[model samples]
Target: MKPAHRSRRRGAPAALRWPAIATLLAAAFATSPPAAPPAAAAANPASFAANCGTKPVTLQGYFETGFPGTVELTKLFTKQYPNVTWKIREDPFAVITQDAPLVLSSPNPPDLMRTPQITGLVKDHILLNLDRFYKIFGWDKFPASDLEQLRVDPSGRPQGVGPVWAMGINYSMTGVFYNKALAAKVGIKLPPATLAQLDEDMAKAKAAGVLPVEQFDSAGNGGLIFPLQYLMADYTIAASGSVQPINAWVLDQPHATIVTHANLLAVEHLDQWIKDGYFNADANAVPYSTMMARFEHGQGLFIFDGDWESGNLDHNFPGKYGFFLFPPLKAGGKQAAMSAPLTYGIPATAKHASCAAYFLNWVQTNPAARALNVAVYGSNPGGPASLPIPPVKPGTVTAQTLAAGRVIAKEDGAMGFIANAAGPIDAEAWTPAVQKLFGGQITPQAVLTTVQADYEQELSAP
Candidate 1:
């Protein structure tokens, strides 16, 4: 990104006003001011050190439900750094992902916020570089992958485009989960990497009176739509020879790069799945829980799910089921991928940066923290292999899974970064476009045509 573009990303004016506002709030309500007893009294803004401890810092923390360790971290951060109180801000993960940039771009930027910030944030220059904070973060103490995951650019190269805002608070992967017993009943193996084979198995399962797969649609957007992204990634990787058809968009932002054959093929596969009854006829409309509920009741023999399902299943009986990464759709294809929700970094102006450091440092050193983090949030920070403490029921995602993902990252010469998570490419176009394609309302060629046309028509115009 250019220097001028970088400047525009400066949280605008709303970001600049936050410190003053936080300071006033802290001072005025130090004692938790009484609720509107009479006329409103003006409050003074609070002040704090941008670095840590020494100067009073008011850290604005953003987190999602089930994001383990944050609430505790806020408390610990305050204790560790006097005068540093974290204004804990929690929201639905999706809302946070979609609007964090807008919120951050506002005048009073978050001093310290959390979200699964995407690579685009780094490309756009909205994050603080933690290169210097390495010493503070005590990077040497943790596994290398975990340390690198925290960096915006682990390679320290600009071309790679790294994470600008968050560290992995929790990690989860999307894949196919199946009932082992049912697989046996259906006379098939588990997690068929090839969808053609899975289709055959599904036919058998359906004949056995089971919904071969439980895939929700838009109403359950969080899981299905998101899990589908991995299929999209695989398609892009196999067809385009690159992700998002980078083309010249790296240098020119006005015009988006074009789509590849595999991109359309992936969408087509999804559409076909819908048509074949392998997925919901209108999966977009059903809630994820309904699908899971069906699967748990043994109404469904197969379920396309991920690690997060484990937590919900464990707490609630989702029947006896086993899981694995969603195998590749193509025959003789590669194994499943590490499609994650992603994590983020902190900004330079973060009020509780130093405090975050203390907690982050603790993240590296403590096993108990890791265990609690996993059980509470269903995340595998670096990888199951790199975990300081072994998570209970570390099923398919063993250290080996983490190792393979790392190897893929190393060999592919780049870790995957989701385009939507980055900046606004256009949710309206993206979701609707994919949904239309998935529903067989369009073809692969048509999907690509739509993306290209949409990009040129909407993003390129003055």
Candidate 2:
């Protein structure tokens, strides 16, 4: 589940206003038909305003209310085009993930919606294919892997590869958040470059009577799962010639199974961490918020989380903390970690499809929007390869995260969340089996066997 209280930028209030897009109208001088095709109407603010005419367009947008970037961007969009009204409905991601298909399938679906339920939405033909807009807005230049997350085959059986069905406004990745003071206290000089070094650091922290790791297992076991998923990603991508088998398995492609050597090792490592007391003794008892609160209070040496927490870390901890992506087992191995798009897609039932598409394109093509994404959202707007990385303020956690994300993105090593292999896979199989492993109720191999059974059952059903 997406955390609700992750809104704060730590100690400081967020600066919500993002940079403005530079005006770049292709239609000028004695252009015959304009050298390049005009940018999508929604992407160009002036054109959208002029084309909107006198009709008042209330864009009904369904989004996870917790996302601050969407809200800030929407405010900027509406301010520029007052004729376009926004009727934004906020909902929890869990509710949206389960209910989005039915809502999108309804006759009067919202014009633009955040689609987490990619399975049913694409299968039901609810989302618009964005291939055309991709060309028009020059989105083809961004990393294909980043765009692939939104892609789905015609049948929607596998995700993360296929035609463009959605667009992400920004990108995020999973990594480790370290308390610098605690690291020094534990006699660690640099971030670990290999799993062996990390194990040593955890041992040092434990020996010094500090919590080696602070993870909240009571809610979703995200603390345990995120790092475990990252390690599995590194193994799967590096150890195979065809990452397809593993990739397909994670997406629940037909005949995919989680019972593999790499996955088994990942589970074994987590079990060992539990035995070594790397995590809090009462980890399963603490909620996610309390986990973050304790981390902020410097109770632990490391907290494995995504760049989504960069904003909070910057505002609260500032120079006191540092962030790094989880290292591979081999010192020089290709690094892989879980990453997801802050994605948005237009529904086929959208009344204002053009307007929504324009908004999507603008966030992507607009420099100001990209800057806002980096600055306010603490996320990298996976822009065209030609576009230079935007300026993130120096000496901030967001800057540190962006630097680490660039390294992994360059290696083409980012992967999808392991739990997202199937919609029900996490709650039904992964979480329960993980809890059982923590409680000694199951063995490492049994955890995979149990989750594999759920994967087969879910994917096999019509």
Candidate 3:
């Protein structure tokens, strides 16, 4: 979920925004290729440091406000390289999703930016392709799945193919987070091993008068989608033995559909949970921060969220929480979760594009930067698989999440967020649709059909 920050403009309707975005991108990029550093920088890993130059250079950055990892890393980089400094503007993730096109096409774009949906941006050449840096930095040595979501073909249809367009400061994964004390009170001695066991656990929590699940589903940022997608992964894997279908749907593969038997079953399960009062009654009104606050204050037994909050939970209420993957359908089924990079990209028009790319590489490979990423962000500081994950204190929530991320890596079950299926899909489609579902105004099938229709319409836009 995005941090709560004031949006600069009311979100423009997708119908109105896409045509304007396409026109702006055409004007911004035209036939010009993205700028690159000297050929020597591409030829040798040692020479890549020279691309930023020794002069005083301040890279302009656009970042999401809530996460401290990026800001901290910028300060560290400046300390290490006194010749470099940063000028960063931070906003909530929702605003960035709505404003990415205008921001990327501006005359003086940020040298580095947190990217939203990139199919349109990549197709229009608004985002700089990072294939050159990929070779120079040997990022290919990291797990291939770590970089797959950032790759885009020339036409930008299928996402997990072709050249890389972005890099992650850290890779994040989402699952179930439970209050340890609350769980024992409800008699859930172990994390559920299957969907049936999970259902029984929620029932026990409800019977004990504990709020079963603390979730958020406000108008623009629906957190319920986290569990919904996890359920989808469970059902999909149970039936087909893989989550590639769901990933394919997220990546915008040809003829891919979210209206599948697995997805329908997932939505139905979510609906049943809502009816069983597993979720808070006023969940529709709650924002991400409110849910976080409520769960930390010991109001709920469980909350579904991402590893980004692991560090925060560890700091605020140490040793009180536990993390687990949303259980699979059958006991031994392969587990999956919405896992992907906190992707940052350079603009085609950035003045310090080379320096921004250098920072991205350094974030992964530099020991200090990687440690900051792990300690502050509580995510996998994605570098080569051989690089040890910075030591996390045992029994901390960060430690559990890091270990869970390894399970995901070994299973190859990393999936992108369904909310990111398109540029406006979350704000305009999934969030509103899920809000209606929470209010009992829509059926389980309607949620899938409604979002799928909006997704198709948005993708087909000129």
User: Which of the numbered candidates is closest to the native, going by highest lDDT?
Assistant: 3
Tens-place lDDT digits, model 3, residues 296-331: 889899899999999999988999999999898999
Comparing 1 with 3 on lDDT, the higher-scoring candidate is 3
TM-score of candidate 2 on Cα atoms, chains taken together: 0.85
Q: Where's the lowest-lDDT run of ten residues in candidate 3? A: 36-45
lDDT of each: 0.54, 0.76, 0.87
Task: Tell me the tens digit of each residue's lDDT in model 2 across 1-462.
Answer: 235456553434434322111123333433575342222223222233313345788889999967877888888877777887888998988888887876776667787888865765677677777765666566778888788778887677787667788888788887898998889888986678888889889988899988889988775544567767766766666567334556677766667777889878878888899999888878767777898999998899998888888887887667888888788778887777677888788776566776788788777667878877777778778778677768877878899888888887777767777777766777788777777777788999998898888888877777
> Each candidate's TM vs. the true structure?
0.68, 0.85, 0.88
Best by TM-score: 3
Which parts of model 3 are misplaced by more than 4 Å?
1-50
Q: Using lDDT as the measure, what is the rank order of every candidate, best first? A: 3, 2, 1
Q: Which candidate, 2 or 3, would have the higher TM-score against the true structure?
A: 3
- Best first by TM-score, ranked: 3, 2, 1
Q: Across residues 106-149, which tens digit of lDDT does each residue of candidate 1 receive?
A: 44556556656445455445555555455545454444444343
